[model samples]
Target: MVSMRSALRTAPALAALLLVLTGCGDSGPAAYGTDDRTITVDHGEKFTLKVPANPELGQNWYLASPRADAGVLKYRGDREDTGDGDGTQFFDFTALSRGKATVKLLFCPYGRCHSADEVASKPVPTATGTPKDSDQEAAYYLYTITVR
Candidate 1:
């Protein structure tokens, strides 16, 4: 009877502790995928630009080089997660210095993008270039970032 009383008294505390622990993990960098036009971060900070992709339907993404200032930011790489059926592609980057840079994300649907080499061959987009929305056939998203 004494042991049962102790367990019952501590059960709620244990449950709360477990809940806090479960939420602790590498949640990755802050995402700037929404309506924010400018992303600001501290020097040496990391951030991710996540976009939807479904390669089964020929939906893909590619990072456009020369669009971003390498002196300000470093392009870490790209990745994909299709486990949830709704595919997602992410571009990881780290702020290198205190300056402004623009990251160009290209969306290619229906296999319009032949290969990475082809995308690489495309000329760099001018700073004033307009980025098309993803719903269109080929869309370009320009993200301006400032690191302090």
Candidate 2:
């Protein structure tokens, strides 16, 4: 059995404990992935993607802006066997549409291929929309990535 005074004394401590367990302060928006290979952007916002100028099949990377014609992105490899990142390639999108856009991390094959050249790609998770910013109508998006 607990006395009234003892219960009262532990009340504040219990409250603090609950807060810690539940997490204090703003947690921001819900994250999109279990890993750090995420990419996100807003309409009219600029973003950058870095990929090895040369990568083998099954190698994983990021791609963005597949739906919009002006912002479509792709990757290409070096012509020769240059081991250096001298083959490092980048596909950046300066202007994207203002809505939910789907992006794919693709396995773009190199070398001479057919007009029906095959490329494997997977859908990368994303949630894009225009958020109210000040008085102006603008697209807003936030993306987080971690590299080991």
Candidate 3:
């Protein structure tokens, strides 16, 4: 029902809008998880480690400091998203130099989280050691990162 002139006028505008929308997406840094035990990145590149954590249920993930080599990787910060009792936690990092670094995360499962001060007081728990003893539900997630 439209005239040729009207269709022609809208065609260019629609194409421009489509091009703009295509270029608006944000491709963030590389993301990893427990399954990705080994990772590599270029110097100065940024990356994040995504873990599942629902603080409302006492599921916590802490960056195990003194584990990763600071000279190679710099810990930036952390962020989280909560929804439907299934939340996600993010640990940000930047590749500082060309070397190898190991990142360790201490996971405190539901009903068993420790304070910052208490993290060092107790021995590091193995990933398989979840609930190994009375009321203590602690585990570790380990990863090796190589920077180039």
Best by lDDT: 3
**lDDT score, candidate 1:** 0.76
lDDT, candidates in the order shown: 0.76, 0.37, 0.79
Ranking by lDDT: 3, 1, 2
| Tens-digit per-residue lDDT, 13-114, candidate 2 | 999999988888746332232122455544455444443434442223334333334333212321223355434434344434544433343323343221
* Deviation (Å) of 115 in candidate 1: 3.7
Summing lDDT over every window of 10 consecutive residues in candidate 1, give the lowest-scoring window.
124-133
Best by TM-score: 3
| Candidate with better TM-score, 1 vs 3 | 3
Tens digits of per-residue lDDT for model 1, 1-148: 5698899999999998988888866587988763554789999999998877888878787886555888998898888998667788888999999999988777777787844457666653333332234344565667889999
Steric clash count of candidate 2: 1
lDDT of 3 by residue, 113-136 (tens): 564345667786656322223124
Clashing pairs in 3: none
Error of 2 at 17 (Å): 51
Model 3, global lDDT: 0.79
